[model samples]
Target chain A: MTRIGRVWRKSVDGRTAALYLLPSIILFSVFVFYPMFRTIYLSFFLTDQTGNAAIMVGFENFVYLLGSSEFQNSMKATGLFVLYTVPITIILALFFALLANEKLKGIGFFRTMYSSTMGISVAASSVIWLFMFNPSIGMFNRLLGVLNLPQIQWLLDPEWALLSVSISTIWMNIGFSFLILLGGLQNIDEHLYESSRIDGAGYFYRLRRITLPMLSPTLFFIITISLINAFQTFGQIDILTKGGPSQSTNLIVYSIYREAFINYQFGTASAQAVILFLIILIVTILQFKLGERKVHYQ
Target chain B: MKKLLTSSLFWVLILAFAVLTACTNSDSKEKNEPTKNDTSSETEGTKDDGAATGEKVSIEFWHAMSGTGQESIDAIVKGFNESQDKYEVKAEFQGSYEESLTKLRGVGGTKDAPAITQVFEVGTKYMIDSGYIEPMQKFIDEDNYDLSQLEENILNYYRVDGELYSMPFNSSTPVMIYNKDAFKEAGLDPEKAPETFAEVIDAAAKLKTDEMYGFSMLTYGWFFEQLVATQGGLYVNEDNGRSGDATESLFNGPEGLNVFRFLDTMNKAGTFGNFGTNWDDIRSAFATGKVAMYMDSSAGVAGAINNAPFEVGVAYIPHADEVQRNGVVIGGASLWMSKGIAEEEQEAAWEFMKYMTTPEVQAKWHLDTGYFAINPAAYDEQNVKDKWAEFPQFKVTVDQLQDTIPGLATQGALISVFPESRQQIVTALEELYQGKDPQEVLDKAAEGTNRAMEIANKTKQ
Candidate 1:
């Protein structure tokens, strides 16, 4: 009787666990998993005007994308974008975090100011940046004129467009990264610093020896998140450039949107999406495999 | 105690995930539930009211008009509702033309679709091929509506196979708008704007100043299409896809090459200002005197004249150096009735469309918004005449349209993949500005269009 009662209790616990998970399970299926599967499925077919899968084209879409110069340009742009935004954002955010971590008067004010950009939505900031990047009436050109420097067509020139977009993206991302890094900086044990000070070690020495190693876990997390965010950037590109100036700013995600929404070529768009998914997956897996070893979790 | 703590922490994490997903899901749920509830309750309420009095058929009209256009449309709808007691038309402002068309796709060919939708001129082929629309010809035939009263130039673009698929509403065409101050400063006659490519190039060279470029055109595909059409050039084979299915792009031919070379000449001479793709940016540049002259939509002429500190002159878009001008194709949107709606609902939509075409309403629309009046008699309206006298630049746009030669080229292309082809043209123009060889870039764009068309053709059911 006791064994039977224990068995019944275990089964009840299992049932209750599943019942508790039902909501999230349903949500995940609806929002994330279903769309993901649909994207993969749609990659194998061509869609008609209404975006309905009309004919099965096998892997022709993928083959075409691989051979197409436009898609190749998109891939290169996305790669360069990721490279341009991630490291700068991480490094800049770290510098700000370190500065704001010091125990001094008005540090809270500095901290708030550093993280202020996190509050502004992507679309709003992009519009503001768009005005600033305008050729004739923008502040940047006026400043250049004042300095007796030749004007740069910040968003219009193909040579400068991608770099300009990257600069704005870096500025937009620094706030969130700064806040997270600051949190991590605050969480570091005070005794380690105290002991270092007692040992007659300088600030740089302590930073190199204790602070960095202790902050490694947080740094790792932030890097991973920033990398993913940079890879998935779409809003600023859409607002500022619309992937123009000879397709110089046509990032893969923006290209996907143009293909899907603007052109209504859902099959090729899905193929692009699938490729993006694979790229992100491989990058994340590589990050885990290689980067995790260096992170020291306390 | 430790085990209990761990178990509690696990539960808390699970609860947090549930809450997060719920928050995201609830937004869409909340949006959907209210609309469903309102529709059901409104129908019931209307049904109950109908039982007591005579039934009023309420139909939805999805339009892509905003700002002044929206206000004018709403006024017209209100007047229509008051004019009659049997039908009520509800006009909903969907976003831009592209966005509204996207939303329409979800409810198209279904009972939930709006009774009427306003689709852009470029979407004509797509809408006809989609099988989601009831051709305006049907309603016109049933009611014996007078089509001859409408503007022939505007009607030419929408009439496919001698049948009108949609009712032409707000129509516009491209015109060259220049600053009279700049033209006079350059010793060029402001009153006599350049009429051909070579003359415009010469004028542009003279107009170039230290601060302002000589010429500019917004890097839009519509303007490119207008340039090609004005030279009596077909965009696609098979009579610009009017006679049959267009199998190849013809824009890479000599006519398109002339446009490219014309721009390339100015670009190489450092007389052309590339204002990117946005209309506002280019217009602002013109307003600020960054560029002396530029191509602008007929619809934008009023605003340009109103906003510019200098006197603005509007003229027909220039043609190739050697060719006679063929004038501009009609751009803008038209009203279409849905096929799947109830017969009475479609009838109400048709009645609303007819009401929209009346001279009084069209005159108001033309005056309130810069879009051309579809009913040509609207120009004879006292208010339009008064307004035209006040702003004579508006007269140039009207004259340009009336002077257009009716042909397959000016009728516009009839391919379902127009948006994609336009994108190709945009990219081609962008490449041209970047100093690429004109023929190479144009050919590349044509090839891209061909691929898109091939895929579209293959996938057609």
Candidate 2:
């Protein structure tokens, strides 16, 4: 009788567990999985003005997108954007996280300041950065003028527009990276550093040997997140550069947006989206494969 | 302990995956949600109050106009609602022009679609080709309404294949507005504005100084479209896509090249300022004395006069010194009647559109906003005449429209993918601004736009 009761209780608990997971699973399916699969399916057909897939032009969109100069440029821009934003954000965030982890008197205030940017939405930050990047009346140019430096056309000159947009993105991302790294820093056992200090390890030596190795898991997490965020960067690029001064800042996401909504060429847009997915997927898999060796999980 | 560790690790993996998917999903989600407001509210509003008031027809009118434009629209709607007790007109501000059109197309064949919609001029071909618009001419023909009462030049733009698809509402034209005080200071006549590109260059050279640029315009395709029209050039093939469907763009021709060269030369000469494509920035630059001359929609005249501390002068858009100056295409939007609504509601919408375009109503709109009156008769109205004397800048647009020839070129490109073409032109213009060869950039842009047109054409088919 006791054995039957145990089995019954286990069955009831399993039912409850399934019920608890239902909402998230449903949401993940509807909002995430459904749209993604739809994007891939719609890649095989041309969509009309109302975004309903109408024409069955199988593989034509993919062929067109792969051969197109515009899509090729967008891929290159997306790559450059990722390269520009990711490492800089990770390093600065690590530096700030280390500083904020200290038990100094004003450390709490500095930590708050470092993570404050997490509160600002991409729209708000992009608008703020846009004003700062304006060529004639912006703060950066005023400072340049004071130093007798020539004023740079931040958003207009094709060479500099992408870099200008990346500056804003890096600023927007630093806070999220800092908060994660800070959590990682605080979780490290205090005795690890104490043992390192007793072993005649200086600050640089300890950072290299202990802090980095101990923080590798968090560092790995941060790197992966930052890379994904960099690939998906859209709002700042949309507002600041508008993918131009000659499509110099036309990242993959922005290209997808322009194609899907602006031009309403959903087939081509979906094809491009599928390519973006493949690119990101391959990149992440490669990161896990190559980067897992260095990430010492404690 | 191992069980707990592994269980927690499994959940963490799920959480990480959820966050990753959610992050990417958020971008398209936020960008797309504004265009999908439930149309259920539209039908209920009619039944709730509309039926209670003795079976009154409640017609929804969706518009993109907001801020000052909304206020004007609200006034007109109120006027129409009060002017008759049989029909109740409900006006809603959907979003930007693009958003409103997207929403309209989304509900294209549905009863929830508004009885009347304000579509921008570029949306003309798309609206007609969608097969969801009840041609305004159908109503005019049914009622035996006199179409000749409308301004021929403004009416010319909305007419295609010998029938009007929509009613011309708020119309403006591209015009050059200069700081008259600055022009005088620079030893150029404030009264005599530059009528040709060469003259503008000459004037701009003198007006530019160490502290200020002489000219600045938003890097927009509308201005390029105007430049194309000023040379009496078609923007698309097949008679500017009026006689037959345009399969390709005509914007890569020598006329487009000349316009590019003119702007590029002005840019290189240090006389023209490049303000990236924000109207507010360009307007503020002119207002703050950073630039002496600017070209914008004629509707910008009111904003200039209100904001600028100096005198603002309005002039006709400049032509190439060599090319004969053909007049400009109309700017701004029009009112289109939806096909799926009730016949009573459709008739009511038609009545409201006609009322809105009358001399008194159009004049009121023209005075409140800087947009040109759709009816030329509005200019002769006593109130409009008085306001014209007070601010003579309003007369320039009227004269420009009056002088315009409603031929194929000046009738404007009526292709479905005009907005896409505009975007492509901006890209080419930016490339030109960055010192790329105009021929290369425009040719490439034209190729892309032609492809967009082909796709649009195929979709329509």
Candidate 3:
């Protein structure tokens, strides 16, 4: 009787565990897992009706996407954006985090101000940036003119368009990364820094040997988040430049939107999206692998 | 103690599961609800009052007109509401033309659907063929509504296969809008605008200064339509713009080459300014006086006049001298009635539609908005004639349309995928405008458009 009761209790526990886990498993299957698989399924076929998949095209979309100049330029733009934004955002966020974390007067207020950019919508920020970059009446050009420097077409010129977008993106995103870094900064062991100071380690020496190594995990987190955000840059381009003057600012995600919605090439757009997903997946895996060597958990 | 810890761990897991399940259920509901609404709206046609209890039948009318246009539409609706208490007509402004179409298509069921919608010419084919729109011919036949009072050409635009699907409220065609100040500054007569393409180019070159462009036209399929029509060539060989069984395209012919060559020349002559790759940008550039001579929809006149910081002179679009006369395609939205409404609601809709198209209402709409009155009788009315005296250029759009040669090209095709096809043509034009060989650009555009047409035609099949 005792053995039977124990067996019944074990089964009941198992049942409870399964019941508890069911919702999340179903949700993941519905939203993330299902869509990823559906996209892969869709990538193999072309659109027949508006959103329906017809006969299987079998890798034709991928081949065509690889050959298109638009896709090529989009990849290049996305690559440049990620390159420009990831390192700068991480470095600047760390600096801001360190500065705000210091025991100084009005430090909390300063910290709040530093992270305030997280509240501003990307659309509003892009509009403000457009005004600031306006050549004839913009503040940036006016300041340049006053300083007797050549005025740049920050949004107009193709060469500077991507750079301008990157600048706005960095400003918009720095807050999230700074907050992440600040959280990590607050978690650090203060005794380690105290011992370093007692041992006559200078600020730079301590920062280089202790602070950076200790903050590696946080930096890694920042890089991962920033890279993902960089690849998905759409709102700024959509609201501001619209991938112009002459497709100079056409990023991958924006091109995906244009292809799917504007051009109504759902099949090709899906293939582009799949390609974007694969690239991000590979880069994220590689980033994680690389991060393992540098990130210090202890 | 170990047992307590284990039990607490289990409780934590359960709590997380509860939160996750709640989120998952809520999100699924959110995603599925909108799609359901969309499907229902497409079928029901705003039957929120599904239970008819002999109460006054209220009908919804969604439109995109705002400001002066909005005020005029509101006045017409108010007058209709007051004219009879039998039906209550509620009019709502639903964003821009594009956004209105999207919203109308997105919602499906009684809570949000409008009984009548003002669909633009670009969306005419899509709405007409979507099986959701009620044929205006049916409404006319049922109610014995007379469409003969409407202008023939304007009425023809809303007709599909000799049957009307929509009624034109206000129609407009592209006309030359030149700056009188810039014209006088360039030592040319502001009253006499450019009459030929060559003259336009010359005037534009003469007017070219450090701050201004000579000429700028919004690059789209419509531009090609006007350009091809100007040179007496059809864009598609199909009847009524349907390209079914069509073997060849007319755009890559001589007319196309001439149009593109003209653009390439203007591009090289520094007569064309940095026109953005879209209609709004092109229009804004022209309106701001950055471009001396602008060509756009005559319907855009009111907005242009109200917003433009300088005097704008409207004139006939310059054509090739070889062509008989200036021909411009009509551009504006028309009221499309969708299917699935009750007889009473449909009658109410027709009443509102008829009221909108009446000479008096149309004249008020046109005069207030600068869009051409679609009713020929409106022009005969003393109000329109009197208003024309103050702004004589308003008559140019009508005069230009009076002599228009209607066919597949100039009549504007009602293809299901016309917008996609237009994009291809625009893309080719953009390539040409950027200095590609004219013939090469023409050939490329023709090829791309034909390929897209083949795909689009398949959808029709």
How does each model score on TM-score?
0.93, 0.91, 0.84
Worst lDDT 10-window in candidate 3 chain B: B25-34
**Which lDDT tens digits does candidate 2 get at residues A181-284?**
99999999999999988988899998898899999888877887788778878788878887887788999888887887778888888888788777877877
Candidate 3 versus truth, CA RMSD in Å, comes to 6.3
**How would you encode candidate 1's per-residue C-alpha lDDT over B1-461 as one tens digit per residue?**
63464345434433433333223212211211112224445456567756663567889988889888999998999999778767888888777788788888989999999999999998998899999999999889989998999999999999999999999999999999999999999999999999899998999999998899999999998998999999999999989988887889999999999999999999999999999999989999999999999999988998899889999999889999788889899999999889898998998899999999999999999998889999989999999999988989999899999999999889998888888888898899999998999999999999999988888888887
Question: Over the stretch B262-303, how does candidate 2's per-residue lDDT look in tens digits?
Answer: 888888889889888888778877888889988989888889
Residue B354 in candidate 3, Cα distance off native in Å: 1.4
Superposed Cα RMSD, model 2: 4.4
Per-model fnat list: 0.58, 0.26, 0.05
Collision pairs in model 3 = B37-B108, B38-B108, B40-B108, B40-B109, B41-B108, B41-B109, B42-B108, B134-B338
**Once superposed on the true structure, which residue ranges of model 3 sit more than 4 Å away at CA?**
A1-14, A33-38, A54-56, A106-112, A132-160, B1-53, B65-75, B103-113, B219-221, B243-249, B278-288, B380-387
List model 3 lDDT by residue over B91-129, tens digit each. Answer: 777766755665666542333456788888878776765
lDDT of 2 at B330: 92
- Each candidate's DockQ: 0.46, 0.36, 0.27
- Scoring model 1 with DockQ, what do you get? 0.46
